[model samples]
Target: MPRPRFWGEALRDDESGSAALEFIVGGVVLLVPIVYLIVTLGMIQSHALGVEAASRHVARAVSSAEGAEDADARAAAVLDSIVREYDLDADTLDVDVSCVGDSTACPAAGETLRVTVAASVPLPLVPPVLGLQDATRIGVESSSVQKVSRYWRDG
Candidate 1:
């Protein structure tokens, strides 16, 4: 027969399985949140890339355009196409255009044109609302600049 042990002896014994069990439990406690964080960051990063690409395309489109009306039309089309391609929320996007000589005025030939796009990437877990007017969200923005043709004159 085995000798009887004291109250604390079982817990302190050289057990092979208990340590492994504890390690697994502790690892699970520590790893789950880390995994979730990684997933969230990856999702946000994809959306950020989409916004950056969209901004660059819009800037290039606007820079090559002739007049303010043409630029606006090109920008609208480019933004819509990009948003569809990236599967991003169109309502959450904000656009800003800046010209070298006059910030608000149309970009003349050879002028530096800048386009900025800002979007909110929704979190993994959040309450969905009918409209995002008041909802707090993660903000991501990208800016792109392009120079218009120096020699070509718009008629």
Candidate 2:
């Protein structure tokens, strides 16, 4: 049999596998979430990029609309395209277009138009069931502005 050890020797002997165990447990508890956070943030950023593009396109579309009557319809169509392209839920996405400087009619000539796109992206590695109340969904929003052509006239 091995010689009996002092208290310090017993303590050192018990620690042989503890480091590896702690490393594994700590890695699972911490490293996994860190990785998931990075991936989820990346996904959220990508969705934000899509929203920004959609906002820019919608602003351009509204700024170029020939008449106020057709502008809303055209803007709706563009928003629909964004929803389809981004695979966003209709209920979770909202778009707003407005004109600056006291212009009631959006896209008024020589005015600046702004488009805001807000959307929710499901968190990466999260279960859909966990997002039932949208707690696991991240909101991504973007706004874009475009100036109407001074020489243009609304029909």
Candidate 3:
């Protein structure tokens, strides 16, 4: 008995589709992680930039000789400006500003002025893929030393 011609043709054709199938599977496997990494880094960069701006504003305000208490209002104004500049909702963000100045002021010269901002945002296809059902919450903190001008105090 001899094998049928149809059977031999069918086996040869089966091997033809195998390469196409492998390429599709490999593409899907490689694409997923690359996409995830790009998204994660982008999110982190945005948060960091916002924080850097906030910290600079707070530091400039606190460095003035008026007093640390006066800096509080200035800090709030700076934070509001950041929210507007970044197009982020005010309600979604929390800002905390701490200043250190003269003895009567914050009692620590050259000390840190810290600004912290936190926000919660939805991460599309990220949390779910990681088996998480909730949105991601990101927090950023930036600190700078107060720079008091001697000329201002002397005048």
Off-target runs (Cα >4 Å) in candidate 2 are 1-11, 14-20, 69-74, 124-132, 150-155
Q: On lDDT, who's better, 1 or 2?
A: 1
**Ranking of candidates on lDDT, top first:** 1, 2, 3
TM-score per prediction, in order, is 0.77, 0.71, 0.60
- State the TM-score for model 3: 0.60
User: Tens digit of lDDT per residue, candidate 1, span 1-155?
Assistant: 98999979977775676878998999999999999889889878988998999999999988887676777799999999999988889998999988766644457777888788999987776666665534746899999989975543454
* Predictions in order: lDDT: 0.83, 0.79, 0.62
For every candidate in turn, the CA RMSD to the true structure comes to 3.7, 3.8, 5.3
**Cα lDDT of model 2 by residue, 34-114, tens digit:** 898898778787788779878998888777776676667777898788778866777887888777678766567889987
Order candidates by TM-score, high to low: 1, 2, 3
Candidate 2 yields a Cα-based lDDT of 0.79
1-155 per-residue lDDT for model 3 (tens digits): 98667977888778655788899999899999899878867866776677677767766775663554556677778888887786555676666655454344441455545555565544546546564634365555565555554423321
Work out how many backbone clashes candidate 2 has. 0
